[model samples]
Target: MNRFKKFMIFGALSVTLLSGLAACGKSEAEEKKSSKNADGTYEETITIDVFDGLANYMGVQEGWFAKIVKDKFNMELNIIAPNVAGNGETLYQTRTAAGDLGDLIIVDKGQQYNELVQAGLLYDMTKYYPGMKNMARFDEAVQKMNEGTDALYGFPTSVSSIPATSPSEGLEPTFGAYLRWDLYGTQNYPKVDTLEDLLPVIKSMQDENPTNESGKKIYGFSLFSDWDGNMLNAGKQLTTYYGYDESGFVLAKADGSDYQSILDSDSEYIRALKFYFEAKQMGLVDPESTTQNYDTLYAKFQDGQVLFSWWPWLGQAAFNTQTNLNAGKGYMMVPIEDQKIFSYGAEVYGGKQFIGIGSNAEDPERLADFIDWLYSPEGVLANSSQTSGSSGPEGLTWEMKDGEPVLTDFGKKALLDGDANMPSEYGGGTYKDGVSALNINTVLPIDENPENGFSYSYTLWESYQRDNTNPVLEDWSSHMDGAVTTMEYLEKNNQLLVAPGASYVAPEDSAEISTLRNQVKSTIVEYSWKMIFSKDNSEFETLLNEMQKTADGLGYQTVLEFDMENAKAQNEQRVAVSK
Candidate 1:
């Protein structure tokens, strides 16, 4: 047998052996009570292993979020995060082949998910459907997801109650050209008209501030290799600034008007690569960037060694400590005149992330209950606290006052006071550490909570918005002609390019297409990095040409053709939803 086939057989034998051993140790009553009761509660506290594809943290979950689930369902979440396991894709495949991908599974809703269904690794959740009251809120979405399936295998994440065409993001796009507003403000906020314009501006700021507080050398551009897949994630992310979304090998325009193969000489992906090359040439790129992981890069941000950021979360959240914010020193979005930021509109069916119960779950019914609660208002508030810095649990972190939600003293301290310790009643860890480790949301954070008539996003809450402004925010607003937020400014200027959300799932790639894609992707990823760090423009051009040639020989055109068709289908959905 082949190596994978051998592993599969060994996995089956191992599972059978483990099951037999467990059966021998279990008492008849213990076995009987292990399954969920008719009341949808477990007879005893159970440890639920969550195979989370999106989790940034791994191991057993703890702190306030843990306490909430434990108190409610007598369960503890033991998260198995592939992202933190070193190699996410490999971990996923290995666990999948082992026939036990944890009791609760969260992953992308695509080929891998279909494979799991075909392998009977996913539990049929149809029996518990009636009890999923909160989940039923997205009835149309769920129906669309399981259209051809015999049973309700799973549902997508970040579902919204808003119309499909409306933008779901509260106050920021997923990607942006964020900068240290404190530094920019000092420099009189130089005008940035295009991506190229950012280079000179960033260099000027870098020259002025050579080091951070502790005198650590700073860089205008610090990249990470950890998140790179088919192409450099750092480079690919730049395409979003121009309103393009990654669709397999192609970058599909947000308005569904155009698509470009990443390998195309003049494509945005290539342009981004050249941008990084120029940054490197100018001595503004971090020397350790190519070798650094995301964690290292994020730590650099916290130390204020980075001046530019592509996402609101990365630069703003990591670096904007309470002290910095209090001092009017923090990061904020700096708009480029020629940019049209891509926005994934509030998806009524949610984004492509899928959550389902594993077939090997000890108590699938109880898991069903846990997942259902995630869709409830209480769960949305508590579980999605990471969403745009939202607070959790009405009484614990926030409460209604004068018919509007406001943060309590504890909430303010825990959330904004830079890792304040939580009360012993709320699992005792620092508030930051106490947030959910799953890192997946059942509903959009921007979705309005029916109970409060406000978005689950604390940043978007009227009371919070009114009280949250600092000097940095005020300065940014003034610079942007009184535009209070990046999303607002983008919308006002027609600079936000939203891909209308629809109940659309791209067709699974053909076996031939999948194989071709893997080979082509490997080549692209390897050469893309080489091109970015090339010795000179001549070397870069040579590397790029070599990469394209090799990839084309490996069937780049075949995969590109497949992706183009998928892109066309995606556009059709966008059009349908727009109507």
Candidate 2:
């Protein structure tokens, strides 16, 4: 059947299935059962409306993990997933507005979770915490923050702990400033330790050789103006390097209290803009960068017309499919500045697409039981691995070996061994070729020590096997120690700023807040662009002042006040907890 018909059929079946479950009233025994399971371990059946992104991988329809759930926990499973077109976010908004929310809804975005909580659409999981002791193992700060006003709306999935290192100990973290190994030979490539080091390399590439086989000039780098690529790669990340902190109500501050909005006349801000403009003028950046989307940029990178660009490692894998550019030839995650990387911490719980129980659930206890079961060791394995027999249209599936959910042999071999010669899982259907040539060239050396003990464990368990341990682990204890020291220093000095409350605003305010934020951000973008393209830096001050004025007119101060209030409230709670 066509995809549309299939989706309709799936949707109807899911609705019917859920309705049937809802009709089955929760028995007293089930409530007692759920309560017991909540405390320790128990099992119950629950239906979940998940997005295709997750369902396609887990093989939910084929019931690959159902037998495990039934045998282990005595639970039945009902899954509702979109088969085509829309993503988790879109489907969630639609269902929420229609009041057709399922017993469990998996929300992916922080903003969305905040809005749902604010709207009272989600159950306060905090109330049930007495039954959920497993949650206690999570970070304390994260648990407290997610329980906004005593109502815990979601569970956090990814949270990185503070590293121990001085800010000045290593190179500054940077974005999109990597040397393209496929285009530039490793021998001639300069050891780029920082943004400053990249200047000479760009000049050499532009001045020395311009065109390749097709007569298209080879640019030193590709600059993207698209929001997803540009904001993530340069705007947000590179801006952070220049001391633009995102924590709590402040944007860019010269002193702790003196907020010199980045959209305004800040010297550091001006310098950053000037750098980009110079790169553009020197023809080091793609001229079409501002206009090109990711696909276009990917195509350019794949064709080897662009030598360097800022993008995720995943993107590199996706586009460079050709044998020459594939595997070891095309990509290398060259760290910018050789500095200790500090990734921005996303929201704790509500940040993930969650599976929330709806008020309409006939057996809330049963539903909660099912969700709890999903969190069990077996459930986590089933969801994460591709051992399940069914492979969805997305060409994604989970595999199980010896009852443990492991990546398909194809996936395991590719990532672990870096076997370029072995075709990817997408190429062959269930082909098991042992002794595939392992490509060891792509694996980077990792620091191994007590500080990185957890990371080391994860790498060993998931990525590397005991039999093949060529990449010897390095001593990263000092680095970890330094990172911890740095964090302690910042916290002691009250310099570990929190992200602005505006960052976690609900989606309900998106239209208005986004418009306001865009206006302010665009001013920064314009001034930065102008500074780069301008022959003189004289206009920088005037441009920044005008941008600030525009921002102030667009409720910048109001937003700042709101964020400050939220931060104050948060701090008060922290103080209370201390007592």
Candidate 3:
């Protein structure tokens, strides 16, 4: 259920320590006791303020996943949503300002983490759940880092429950361009080494399949305005080709902590914008790219009307849609020239959601224990095995076949083919958590899951066959007579890097530059889109000049100065640590 949304690499995270508030935690004798009625059933309700796509509870109230939670904790989830999104940013800010944030809360890392901690709105789990010390998926160090200077408050969620130190052996370009698989195959899978080089392939394919059998128009490349949240838009993915997280004011090469405004004719963003410009001139730009939201764009892709995806996950589901069944295909993660997947692992979190209990909760201890349990192997198993629907559904939600944890056929169907709206059908809270954020947003580690079982690996499920006893890594080996998958391409090229995304520059250093930073980023993106779409090269050049002038006039250089200082410090730390 955890997945990338725009920029979020969804997965649950691990544990930390908070000794000062330790008494609120259970005594040794209390650990054996469950907070249940004498009948051993949870009869209460706990409210949660959720964010983004997980707000759907239309039929999730009957989901079995929800039932498991009630059966274990004697309580049920009461889901809440903000009037607006950005992971409940407005709601959280408003609630924190008022000094209450429901019984439970889930927010993205960074800004929200700082806000809640600075406001003293979250409970310190160490005081209430000393038991976190032994959690199977616990991460004392990450928890400590997130805790900052205060007692640990937020529980890191939506991150790997267990850590894998080894580099990934696949070419899953979390960031980069993706093309509809069948189209690329038809073109003989030509190498696309740069953004400009990709233009012709898309145009050629669009020419061949200009319209679907239904006659809907297909575009060569499309963009989404929604992904431009907080300044950077989809173009940030282009920065990934250079192995850096796009901070707008700062840029680095190969994940080197050398920050500063590196935007130039040769910079990643400039190159990406120029590529878009060329695509536009060549009649390959989607008019919708400037007007549509991701939902609209995805709908087009779902119908196979989309020819190229700037972000890999944006078009993932579309490839598997029933409409694309005969035409059903996936996107090949084609690399741009010289681009390599940054070597990623524990240091770089794909993305994470942190969880926490409200400070005003009647009993923080129970909530803390519930979280600790979620991170434990047992908790992760229960939380993760929500028989499939959406994403990959080829494994058991949870089951034992001949002493091996295995996925059942029915379970796989429930995930892939089952109804998204199950609450109306199942009734009685059986599907209450089905298709909701709660289904994901908890801790679990896929790498640690065993073979011949229901692991969280999508590659395994998508390629899983009844004849294969060992499931997880076999997809690549089984394909095309031992031919590597897209992931294997990057692994073979060693493009992966340890760029855990520029946490090198601490938050405070950039706090003063927030306004200027936003101004510069907004201006760049504004012009980037315009320049790309401009009818004349002269007009495009004019906009580019204006964009730079506006940034310089707004003291963008001062912003870069601070970034440079912190980046040097961060790189120093990186060097020292490596040595």
List the candidates' TM-scores in order: 0.93, 0.56, 0.78
**lDDT of candidate 1 over 89-185, digit per residue (tens):** 6677677667677789987676656766766678888878998998888888888777778888898788888877777677777888999988887
Question: Candidate 2 local accuracy as lDDT?
Answer: 0.40
Q: What are the lDDT figures for the candidates, one per model?
A: 0.79, 0.40, 0.54
State the displacement of the C-alpha of residue 92, model 1, in Å, after optimal TM-score superposition: 2.1
RMSD of model 2 against the true structure? 11.2
RMSD of 3: 6.6
Candidate that beats the other on TM-score, 1 or 2, i.e. the better one: 1
For candidate 2, the 10 contiguous residues with the lowest summed lDDT are: 1-10
Best by TM-score: 1
| Count of clashes, each model | 1, 38, 39
Summarize candidate 3's per-residue lDDT along 25-101 as a digit string, tens digits: 32232343444466634466654333322343322233555555655664556665442244444444455555665
Tens digit of per-residue lDDT, candidate 2, span 1-579: 000001111111123333433333222322332333534444444444433223322223323334445444454444444423334335645565554455555444355455555445566554465655434434353364465556555554322222212121111122234445533343364566765566677677556657765787778766554332111234444444333433222443212233433343444344456566667667686767667755576667656676665433323433333344323444433434433333223222212234555544545555555555444333332332211111111112224345333445444344333332333433332322211111010001111212223221123233233322221111111222332222343334343333311113222333555455545555556655555555544664566566567768977766555545544444343233223
Which is superior by TM-score, 2 or 3?
3
